[model samples]
Target: MQWRGRRQSSNVEDRRGGGGMFGGSGRMGGPMRIPVRGAGGGLGITGIIILLIAAWIFGINPLELLSGGGSLGGGGGQTQSRTVDTKASDEMTQFVSTVLAETEDTWNGIFQAEGQTYKEPRMVLFSRQVQSACGTASSASGPFYCPNDQRVYLDTTFFQQLDQQFGASGDFAQAYVIAHEVGHHVQNLTGILPRFNQMRQSMSPEEANRMSVRVELQADCFAGVWAHFTDQKGLLESGDVEEALNAATQIGDDTLQKRSQGYVVPDSFNHGTSAQRRTWFQRGVQNGRLSDCDTFNNPV
Candidate 1:
């Protein structure tokens, strides 16, 4: 992504290794689990050597593949986040910050050209748990933007999960995840999120989920908008856009449900189907016009 030595956004707050990430838990059935190794109990040295050899030979991730999946599972997960390796951690943080700075530049210029002020949203990096105006949440919720705080919260680990768990790998895919969450911030700036939240107050569960899907699709379009700016900057190589599109397709509510929970229900879909998600993102990319992102106006 040509991201080395790029300008890093000063808005990042690192909360890794902190304690008590859950101020209020139980959203989406507690913290989401990452695939990792289970206990390899009662294994002899020969067994261990054989396993390690198999891990290397078969391309298994020793972290989870041999032991079990990553965590035994974070419980009562009050912070105490794991510390990231300095070099590896800095690389991701820097990449995210640079991307954020780029978004600020893109949005600021676009807004100024229209005689408006663009508020650059802050991005927060945390671990297992973090508090927000919205409430306490685990990174299991993925990258989310809190409208009340006007900041985007990310657990860099989410990127690792994208490749290891979601089967969506690619720097651009990782970038798309960041861009999608930032898209929600953009929606907040446009008052789209709150309005929808308010409108959903009187809606039935089914209706609310439908509205949520529209909101998600709109965010996808916004990600496309970000891509549009990057495109102008010659930042994208061939298949870069495809990586993002594939990611969008891969993470749809339906797809995620099938992968994580198995099966799908149209009425329960809050993030639209894979096809719908990819389509809206493509709409934004192809048109590169904000007006083209009227996802609510169309019935998908």
Candidate 2:
């Protein structure tokens, strides 16, 4: 986690001062929409009927799609605005830039080895709410990667929440979060995410959730792979790997459900269980091989 003095990524875009065009009220009214690639226009009556039929067949709540709530499976809602600490915020920005640069180095080399060009994604730093190609999202949505725009969106305060609320502190844990989203960028480039998005349209909610767990776990593994290479570069400090694993555990769908609702619903799990997440991440750390990070073909 010795990130200071490291090269910072120039791909970062700062959009913190101004509120998004959607406003900074953080109140989400109107119809909810999940930002899927190639998604546009209003749903016609026939489209609604199809969605209803799909929900009926898939055993999912039709309202989730209609209301635009849990269709994509990440938390998002109103978040209160807080005063920013200028010094700390700037430092965190530097830290994030350094981590992103490191990821670029790791993935660039890996892609080159495979004779493919790695397209580095831009990172958007926002406060309160931000607009993405996928749509507008609040800080409560946490850090996310928009396949539509191929950019990683982050609210640096999430790092504070990860430490205080989730009990997953340490710079490495923060790095893991950034790396996981960047991993999605890699998946998007490799056609994995595009294919998944296409196939999920026909899949039931349960099926989609099952597939999502694999996708998320694969990202965790990719983060681990980044860690492995980072460690090789002598950047990892003692307890760094453990910090990343602990972050993975804290954010596992099962763990989050248990913490929020005091119960676990396996069918609704899209991010895998804590053990599954840890196992996949460990696999990546141990092997650092893309072949070993296959979660779809292998049991996760």
Candidate 3:
């Protein structure tokens, strides 16, 4: 949580205040504003830094971001606008840069130790919705990683939402969110995502959702793996591990369902239960072994 004066990552593609290409970010509770990095004109930064800290960022469609629904309602055009305040804007940008630098250091070392190349994913900061190789997403969609471009898209205010709405506060919790996206990138590197997507071709919706659950849960585990190395390198502080576990518990598909939908549909859960999330995260924290995160072979 003590992040200040650290080197920020240069790979960040800031799109916070660009052309009026997107709309304001909205959620069930209320409308939220986020600090953005300016984008020249493209799907570079993340517009959806909040339905979650998972897979929603990149694969979501553009219409979904603008219209606030799947229909798109016929006015499907891109807009360009700028929305950013100087003071808050500065802080958010700095914080993300520092966090990204940490991720780069940890992941690079991890890949190096394995005799593999560590490709760092660019982090895009955007306001509202932005375009991506994956698709267009609204800030309401939450932070997500785009495997197609190898970048992480985030709406900075989601950090506020994580604390207020999801009850997952603290700096380490935020880092866990980013780490989870990075985890998806890790899965891509290992061919897990492509293989899983391939399996979805012949799968029933329920079965495919099950596979997606495994994929997401393993992402949680991979995030935990990052925490393990971070701790060893003195980047983790006291109570940091618990903060991550708290975050893992907060965003569990079951927990979110109960909070938002008033019921739990086990069949539709993609991110796993809170207990499952915590256990797998702890698995990587303890072992720090990539092999230990074999969620596919194990039962959910």
Candidate 4:
């Protein structure tokens, strides 16, 4: 990806080596057990059922309730911190910062063209666990963007998992991960996320999951848009685009579910299938237009 010596983002907050208690715990179960690319922590089936009942009785958005009230806090109690190789961690940090800076440049120009101010979101680099406005999350939650705090939380170790576990190895694949989370931040700013959260309050779990697939696919498309511009800047090397496509395919809900459990539940999918993800991403890459990335209004 030729990212070295690039401008690193100032919005990066290094929280590595910081010890914290594991506050929020529960897996949002499906065959896809890895970290998702959106806001909030995992909610088990029990948690979902409880939240749905509570939301129905109180007429509140479940997502808002999941994100606890009050300012964001760091962990309150001590836990054993994960050991990280300092030099390797530093290099990974630089790589993420550079990728983030590139996304900023791409989005800033696009927003300017539309006569809107682009508020760049911060990226929090954590080791084992970190506290967010949504809740406390461990590295197992993967990389997620919390709309409550408008920051993207990432664990560098996930990059290794993407390569070794998912077989989506490449620098561009890593960049796609960061860009996808940042795309969620863009959705937050554009009011798309807020509307989805509000509307999902009344939706059945299946219906909500359907809508979620669209939301996630849109983010994937937005990531592709960023890539289009990045490529225009001559930053993309040979096979870069293919790397991102492979990453998208590797993380598709259907693919993950099949790999993890040897089956698939179409109704349980929040993220799109591999083909859907790749199609939407390619649509964006082909045109670099936000109009082309409309997964909600169009048949995705």
Better of 2 and 3 by lDDT: 2
List clash counts for every candidate, in order: 20, 0, 21, 1
Off by over 4 Å in 3: 19-89
Residue 111 error for model 3, in Å?
A: 1.4
lDDT, candidate 2, 137-162, per-residue tens: 77777888877667788888888888
Give the whole-model CA lDDT for all candidates, comma-separated: 0.66, 0.72, 0.65, 0.73
Model 2 accuracy (lDDT, Cα): 0.72
**What number of backbone clashes does candidate 4 have, counting pairs of residues 3 or more apart or in separate chains?**
1
Q: Once model 4 is optimally superposed onto the true structure by TM-score, how far is the C-alpha of residue 92 displaced, in angstroms?
A: 0.8
Order the numbered candidates by lDDT, best leading: 4, 2, 1, 3
Off by over 4 Å in 2: 21-89
**Model 4 / residue 259 / CA error / Å:** 0.7
TM-scores, each model vs. reference: 0.77, 0.78, 0.76, 0.80
lDDT of 1 at 67: 38
lDDT of 1 by residue, 1-300 (tens): 656776667766677665354665323212211111110110224223423443453344544423333212122322233333334566787788788877887777655665545667767788787776566877667777666666677888888877887777888887887787777766555444544555566778899778777778878887898888888888888888898888887787778777766787788777788899899899878866776666665676
lDDT of 2 at 232: 94
Winner on TM-score (1 vs 2): 2
Task: Indicate the worst ten consecutive residues by lDDT in candidate 1.
Answer: 33-42
**Model 4, 192: alpha-carbon shift in Å?**
0.4
What would the TM-score be for candidate 2 when compared with the true structure? Answer: 0.78
